[model samples]
Target: MRAGGNIEITDLMRFGHLAAAVFAGWILIAPSIDCARRGLQRETPLSEWEHMDTFTTQQGCESYRATVIEAEKADSKNLYNARYAYSLCVRDDDPRIKGE
Candidate 1:
């Protein structure tokens, strides 16, 4: 990206690589849920958790997700907020989130 919204060639190349890699790897699905309404805060690609980088492998995604869960468990935060009990890892190409 540059001034006047011009996309640089380098940016296109990077996006091309990422687009290809998206089909070959895993993505961590870290969704925060509103328990009372049983509503999901990650029902779209624009969700805040989408900012997390994609993992190149399921093992990597699982390892990171587990660490997050452990941290959440250890932290005695207020329960009035959100919960990540439904957080998980899914293939990047999964139909549910891949917009297929």
Candidate 2:
């Protein structure tokens, strides 16, 4: 967290592998969802997804997700074409981001 309790992008990259911290707030799961090849990735556990930075508010989480998707679009390798490969903004307590 910086001077404003805001997380830097680099921090997210550094800790991307640790998806579910289950903080007291909310979190964004920016997993690599290739439904075309994996079929919704339902067999994969949420903890395996690439976790984005945590947010205190739903609006903030969605805003960051949009920002990330926009940036990903610039990269030709992004998974925007997938049927369900978008970041999810859910409360840390959400069971979906936990053990299956």
Root mean square deviation (Cα) for candidate 2:
12.9
Best-fitting candidate, scored by lDDT: 2
lDDT of 2: 0.66
Task: For model 2, give the 10-residue run with minimal summed lDDT.
Answer: 77-86
What ranges in model 1 sit over 4 Å off? Answer: 1-23, 32-51, 76-83
User: Which candidate leads in TM-score?
Assistant: 2
lDDT tens string, model 2, 1-100?
Answer: 5666898888887686455443357788756566577534545667766666888888998887777666666665545523224567878877777764
